[model samples]
Target: MNASYRGGPTVERILPNEEAHELLGLVTEIADGELAPRVADFETRGVFPRDLVRTLGRAGLLGLPYPEEYGGAAQPYEVYLQVLEILASRWLAVAEAVSVHTLSCYPVAAHGGDQVRKLLPDMIGGELLGAYCLSEPQGGSDAAALTTRATRDGEEYVVSGTKAWITHAGVADFYNIFCRTGEPGPRGISCLLADAGTPGIVPQQPERTMGLRSSPIAQIAFDDARVPVDRLVGAEGFGFRIAMSALDSGRLGIAACAVGLAQAALDYAVDYARQREQFGRPVIEFQGIGFLLADLATQVAAARALMLAAARLRDAGRPYSTEAAKAKLFATDTAMRVATEAVQVLGGAGYVADHPVERYFREAKVLQIVEGTNQIQRLVIARSLTR
Candidate 1:
C-alpha cells in the first residue's frame, strides 16, 4: 500500500524512483504500527525507548543517504529527509533521535581515516548508536569557545571537561567528542571518537526537559578520558571546519523535521475542525476558523517545499548552506506557529495532554533553538548575502 498518513495525504511528494516510494511505504508501516502507539505512553513516563531505536536500526531505517558499502542505503539526501519527515509526523522524538544519530556519524563518515572509517558499517547500520559532544555548558551558540581539553599523551589523548545538552547521552554506544587540542579559538579544535566504555567518561543525570522526554538529554563529563590517537577523525585544528560542515547538513535535517511536525499539527487541527460542531454547524464551516486552518496548511506546504529544495541542492553537490539555514529558520518558525494554532483550534483540549498538539507545541520550540538558534540562522543568511 502507498504510505498514506492518518487517512490522508499530507504532501504530494515526487519520488525519484519506485524504490524510494517503496522505502517510504515501509517506513510508514513501521511508524504507524510501532512508533506512533508508544509515543504518548513513553513521553508520559519520561522513558527512553532503546529497543524501539534498535528495531528501527534492524529495519534499515537508520542508514539512508550514506554509501551502501558502509551499510547505508545510499539514498539521495532528499529521499532520506522525506523518511525523516514521515517519522517526525508520527513521533518527533524518534525523528530527532534519528537526525542526531546521523549528525554524530558525520565526522567519522566524512573525515575519518581508513581505520576509523571501518567502524561505519556498525554505526550506519544501527548496531552502535551515537552521540555528539560539541556544546559545553559555557558554549552553546558559540561552539568554537568550548574548553574541553584533549591533551596528547604517548599514543593517546587525555580528555577532560564536560559536554552539555547532549542527546542520547547515556544510551549511546559511541560519542563524537570535539575537544581543544591546541591554542584558543576555533583553530584549536579537533574531533575524537570515544567508545562509551572508555574510562573516565561519564554521562550525568538526564535533564528534565520541556518536551522529547523519551529521548535522553544530559551533560557528559570526561575526566582524563584516554582516547587513542587513531580515534581522531580528522587532522588536529581542522575540527571547526568539520563541525560547521556537518551542521550545514544537520540543519536541513531539522528543517525536514519541522515540516513534518507542522504537517502533523495542521492535520490534527483540520480534522478537529471538520468534526467538532458549534452553533449547529461544524467549526470548519465558520470563515474565521477555516481561514486560519487554510493559512496553516499553506505554510506547512511552503515549509516542506523550501526544505526539500535545500535537500535537492545538497544532493546536487551545490552550495546549500545558505538555503539550509533559510529552510531551518522558516520551517521551525512555521512549526511553532502551526502547533500553537493547533492548540488554539482544540480550545481547552489542546492545552491538556488529551491532545498531542500540546506536546507538538513544546517540541517545536527546541527545533528553533538547536542546530544553531533561529537568530543564528539569520546571521548565517545575512553573512552569505554580503559575501
Candidate 2:
C-alpha cells in the first residue's frame, strides 16, 4: 500500500536543504515498506510494535529534531514534523509512540544536569524507550493541580503518586515523573527521571481506549519510588515551566499526526468513490460525493499548511506557543471532521473492519483531546492574544 494511498494530493514542502529532502524520501520509503503493510494486523490485534520502535530508532527517525551529539538527526522542527506526518498517514500508533517518546526526552535533554544528559544518547538512539508522567486522576487539563508528591530525603527523592493516562506505561525504559516537592500549585513541582525498574514503581493495566490500543496508555502508581537527587531535571520549582515548554513542541507533533490521519481518510474516501458505482456510474462522478471529497481535501491541505507554519516559527526561535496551540486546535478538529465525512462517504462499508476509514474516525477523536484538549488550546490562544 502506498503510504498516503494512491498518489494523494502533492503537499509541496519547504525543506531547508537537499539533505532534508533526502531524509523525507528515506522516511517515505521506510513508512511504505515497513509500516503500511503491518499496521492493520497490529492494530486489529491491539499489539504494540516494539520492534518497529527500534526500527525507527535505527533509521534516525526517533531523534530527528535533537542535536547529533546525542544520537539525533539535528533536523529542523519543520522537517521532523513532516516526517511524523508521513509515518502517521501509514500507522497512527507508531507515529504517536514516536511523538510521546520524543516528548519524554525533552525534560532531560533540555533541563537535566550533564550526568543526566549523558543518557539521552541511549534514549534518542532507541536503546531505551521513555514515558512522560504528568496527568493524575485529579488533574487532567489542570496540570498545575497535580497531586503527585516527591519528598527530598538525603541522597534520594521518595516519589509517591498516581499518574493517569500515561503513554508507554509499563514498557518504557525510563519515565520523566512530574511531582510536587514544596507547597501546592505549579511552584512546588519538580521533574525526576526515574528508571523503569525502580522499586515501588507500579504500572496498572492498560486502559481499554477507543483507539490507539497498541500505544499502551495506563495509570502509573509511584509508591515511594526512590530516585537519585542527581536525576532531578532543572531546579526544583521549575518543572511546570519545563512541562509547558515541552508541551508547546508536543502539540505541534499532534497537529502533524492529525493532518496525516485526515489525509489518509480523504485518500481512502476518494479511492472508494472512484471504484464504487451507483446509477451505472462511479460514485465520484456524483456532485454530492465529489463536493464532499473536495471539501475534505481542502481542509486537509489547510490543516497541513497551518501545522507547517507553526513548525517553521518554532524552528526560527520565534514565540510559537500561540501558533502551536492554534495549529493543534484547527488541525485536530479538521481530522475529526474529515474522518467523520470519510465514514459517511463510505456509508455502511466504512463502519466495518474491511476498510481503514472507521479506524481513522475512531483515532481522530482522541487527537482533539490529547496533548492538550481543543478547549485548552483556545484558552492558550486567547491568553496570548489578550496578553
Candidate 1 local lDDT, 1-387, one digit each (tens):
111224236468799999999999999888888887888889989998889888888888788978888998999999999999989998888998899999999898899999899899999888899998999998999999999999999999999999999999999999999999999999999999999999999999999999898999999999999999999989999899999999999999999899889998888888888989999999999999999999998998899899889999999999999999999999999999999999999899889887788888999999999999999999999999898
TM-score of 2: 0.97
Q: Which lDDT values do the candidates have, in the order given? A: 0.91, 0.91
Error of 2 at 114 (Å): 0.7
> Residue by residue across 312-361, what tens digits does model 2's lDDT show?
89889998999999999999999999999988999999888777888899
Question: Given candidate 2, what's the lDDT at residue 255?
Answer: 97
Q: List the residue pairs that clash in candidate 1.
A: none
Cα deviation of 357, candidate 1, in Å: 0.7
Show model 2 residue runs off by greater than 4 Å: 1-10
